[model samples]
Structure formats: structure tokens, C-alpha cells
Target: MSSATTYESTSSGHMCDMDRTPIRHAEAIAARNERDEVYAKEAKARELLRITKRKAEKTKLALRIAEDKVYKYRQALFLSWTVLGVYFVFSTVFGGHGHMQLHLP
Candidate 1:
């Protein structure tokens, strides 16, 4: 005739007659906490994904700029070398260096 949970022990110090309502309540509380943990992790995962996308975009743009700069520098170096070669050839043929000359007959 009692509404409260009770536990009885035997002579060997082991539990005997015990009520199960408290056990079920404890299991339910644990399950609810586990469900809440999943929700919390979902929000954290979304934030991490967003940050990763931003970093990838920045890295992609930096790589493109670096490639463009290298191409321009390489082209300019080739042009400078070509101009120097032409100047040397003209100087030799016109007697500017006095090493060689062209005579017209």
C-alpha cells in the first residue's frame, strides 16, 4: 500500500525485493542526454565546415595569383634577354665595339 520505491536486502548483503520504477527513470534520463549531445555536435560540425570552405577559397585565390606572377616574370625575363642579344648583334656589325665591322663595296 506504499507509493514509494523500496529495496530489501538478504542475509548475504545482496539486494532482494527492489522496485524497478527508479531504474527505468535513470535509463530514460541517460538516453535523453545522449540525444541532446548529438544535437550539440551537429551545430559544431556545421561551423567547422563553413570555416573550412572559407579557407579553401582563400587558398585557391592565392595559388592563382602566384601562378600569374610567375608567368609574367618569366615572360619579361625572356623579352629582356632577347633585346640584349639584338643589341649585341647590332653593335658588332656596326663597329660600335671595334671587334667586327661590315664594309660595302
Candidate 2:
């Protein structure tokens, strides 16, 4: 038997036989390389997905903060409008009071 026709026992109680041509080994190596490349692409995709998810979460949090700010300022906005309306009314009613005031004759 040639050196190329070697046999070894595997840990799983199986026999690893290397017989015939050396092209089989080359083919196996190529297959393994292809698998590794696929795994690398999968890892990169997962990393990108993680980054996108984080960005989405940040955007959602920012939106929530903005919503909370709007909610917190709701009363202030209403109060400002109310004050403006009251000022307009008061100015209309009392604007002539100052102009009509006369000095003692």
C-alpha cells in the first residue's frame, strides 16, 4: 500500500480512509474555504443588523423624548394662549381709560 492509502481511526469510532487520488483532499479544502467565506458573510450581516437595530432603538428613544417634551409643554402652551387672549381683552377694554382721563378743571 502506498503512503497515500493511509487509514486512521476517528474519535467517533469511524475510520478515516485516505485512498485514491490526492484531488479529494484539495476538493475538501476548497469546500471548507467556501464554508468559511459563507460564515464570514453571515457574521458581517449579523453585525450590520445589530448596528441597524441600535440606530432604530436610538431613534425610537429620541422620538419618545420629543413626545414627552411636547406633553410636558402642553399646559404651558395653553397658558400662553390664555394669557394672550386675556391681555387683548384687557387692553381693548382699558385702552381708552388712559386716553379719556382728564386733569382737574
Candidate 3:
């Protein structure tokens, strides 16, 4: 028999024919190309997700540093105010004790 008309018989007495048509080969190639395109798109999406996660982590670190600086500045301001208040009280109570002997002619 010619190659075009060749068929193989299965163990169950079924004839299996090979498809040698150009249209069938073209369809298979198109299906494979579509699968490759889908995989490429998935890879691009994963890359973008990784980049976004890195940026988010950097932003979070910067925010944490800024918050720490603000907290330290607040503590320093509170301490400065406490010291100033204590000095003011001491000066008001003792500033005139040593100047009581002033006389006017």
C-alpha cells in the first residue's frame, strides 16, 4: 500500500490511521506557539511581582527609619522641656536671696 494510505491495526482489531495533512501540522504548530506565548506572559508577570515586592520592602524600611527618628526627636524635646522647667523654678526662688542689700542714695 502507498504511504498515504498506510494504516496500522491495533491489538483490538482497530485500524489507526496517521494524519499526514498539512492543515493538521499547521494547527499543531499554532497550538504550540500559543502555549509558548502564555508561558512568556506568566514569566513577565512574575518578574513584575518580584520588582513590586522589592520596592514595597524598601519603602517599609524607609518608613520605619523615619518613625524611629521622630520618636527620638520627641524624647529629646521632652527632656529639654523638663530641664528648662526645673531651671526656671530654681532661679525664681533663689535669684533674689543674694541681692537683698542694695541701697539707693
Candidate 4:
């Protein structure tokens, strides 16, 4: 009888431990899943940030190129106007018969 009682008690204890094992395993798996989800979100955010930064850099470069083109065009226009003005002055003063000649009778 004593041996039988000992055996029953040992079996019940083992059964209880067995019942708790699966619950513990489930909790651990849930915690790991949560951690993996957080890591995935962080990775996605980093990728988005990198893409945005690259676009901003491209835009800045494009703006600089446009500004450089505008500066060159303005310089060319100013040079053309100056040349035209000089040509007009020379033609008016020296073209055809001399306008400033003195006639001594």
C-alpha cells in the first residue's frame, strides 16, 4: 500500500509539470514573435528614411544645376547688349560724311 501511494503521488506531480510545460513554451513563443515584429518595423522605417534622404539630395543637385544655367545665360545676355551699344555709338559718330568737320570759307 505504501509503495502504491508513493507511486501515485510521483505520477500526479509529473502530470502537473507536464501540463505547465506547454503553457510556458507558448508564452515564450509569443514573446519572441512580438520581438520579431518590432524588429521588422524598425527595419522598414530605416529603409524609408534612406529613400527620403536620397530624394532630397537629388533635388538639391538639380536645383544647383538649374541655378548655374541661369547664371550663364544672364552673363551671355549682358555681353550681347554691351556689344550692340558699342556698335551703335561707333556707327553714329563715324558713318558717312564727317558731321563735325569745320568749313573755312
lDDT of 3 by residue, 1-105 (tens): 764466666577665546445667898999999999999999999999999999999999999999999999999999999999987777678884355567879
Model 3 pairs in collision: none
TM-score of each: 0.66, 0.61, 0.71, 0.65
Q: Could you list the CA RMSD of all candidates, in the order they appear?
A: 6.9, 7.3, 5.5, 8.0
RMSD of 2: 7.3
User: Per-residue lDDT for 1-105 in model 1, tens only?
Assistant: 332334665567765435665687888999999999998999899999999999999999999999999999999999999999999989978878765556669
Model 3 earns a TM-score of 0.71
Pairs that collide in candidate 2 are: none
* Ranking 2 against 3 by lDDT, winner: 3
Clashes of 3: 0
TM-score, predicted candidate 4 vs. hidden true structure: 0.65
**lDDT per residue as tens, model 4, 1-105:** 554333343544553355566799999999999999999999999999999999999999999999999999999999999998887788687873476678999
lDDT of 2 by residue, 1-105 (tens): 553355655577565555424578889999999999999999999999999999999999999999999987998899999999997788788874465678888
